[model samples]
Target: MTGLVVPAAARVLSARELRALAEVAERERLGWNANDMSLDEEVLFFLLPYSYEAQPMPLWKCRVIAVSGGLPVEIGEGKRIRFGRLDVSLTTFRRLPVASRKAERQLLHWLAWEAAVASWRSVDEDR
Candidate 1:
């Protein structure tokens, strides 16, 4: 029997996305229980919006692995890629709550705000 293999190009959430996800976890008060079942479940819950036809397992697994290192992984190449994508995506206004669009823009904005704050705090702590 062979196990399913996901390609490297498979869409894993970038670091910024993961940080935004961590913000969702933090907002839900799940940050303190890093390795708990409830925290894992909550993370899955946030990913629900991005799911297709109720099958979010693959994407969820990828994201969970990326974020498992910590709430805010060091800002690096992945973060640069995430920000670049956001820059391109925010150039136009779009409707939301509809099946196709969902609330992706709002979610991204919120995540960006959270990531900024987290970055600032990390910098402050270094001083």
Candidate 2:
């Protein structure tokens, strides 16, 4: 939605989309822009989207997060990648939800505003 235009913005999001966009406006007011959050707090801020036909957050999806995730994780060969205390497989990570619908819709909306500026990150090199 940022780089490319979609054919039509649907009426279905009249409430949802407007609210989410408004929140994007309110990010600084919400302390979302605060730089003092702990590592765990940042982790919690991730994964607030997906799951009617899907998934939660930390329990199942912590791995794929390392891929395309906001933070850096040490990655190496073999099936499992060690991240902190947990070792997770590449297969498991890819299967996890980027967002979980089971989460409050408000949270899902809020997470969309993650402020990190995008830069070129090659997965092979990052890994």
Candidate 3:
């Protein structure tokens, strides 16, 4: 009945990173299994939404490896939590990424700064 949780600091992922992870999930969905994942790979397993309240999400026999931050992580197939290859079977969802309100503000600020810089560069190039 245990569910999985991810903190924001354990890993930082973008939409593009999540999409890359989907590629691995798609492989699992296809019936091919891998033993370990690479840390350099940015994909993470998306846990089942309803299973969050469960004491422990069930574990499937098959295991896969996911690499995050340039290392390998291992995980069972049945759990609802997302994990890197190094974090397999650890049951510590606190490591997952969780952003505080302050963190969100900083993220937004950085995003705006990056956009402005990009636009300025583009304008300068045309001049």
Report the number of backbone clashes for model 3: 27
Across 25-99, the per-residue lDDT of candidate 3 in tens digits comes to 464342223333332334433221121222233222222322232223245422122232212222433333544
The total of clashing pairs for model 1 equals 0
lDDT of every predicted structure (CA atoms): 0.32, 0.27, 0.36
Candidate 3 stretches greater than 4 Å from native: 1-96
lDDT of 1 by residue, 3-106 (tens): 44422222334345445555654564432222332333222112322211213111222222212332333556132111211110111102111212333343
lDDT of 2 by residue, 32-125 (tens): 2223322332243332112111222222212111112223334652121112112222343344334434433433233343322122244445
Per-prediction TM-score, please? 0.29, 0.20, 0.31
For residue 71, give model 3's deviation from the true position in Å: 21
- How big is the positional error of residue 79 in model 3, measured in Å on the Cα after superposition? 35
Choose the strongest candidate by lDDT.
3
- The candidate with the higher lDDT, 2 or 3, is 3
Which RMSD does model 1 reach against the true structure? 14.9
- Candidate 2, poorest ten consecutive residues by summed lDDT: 6-15
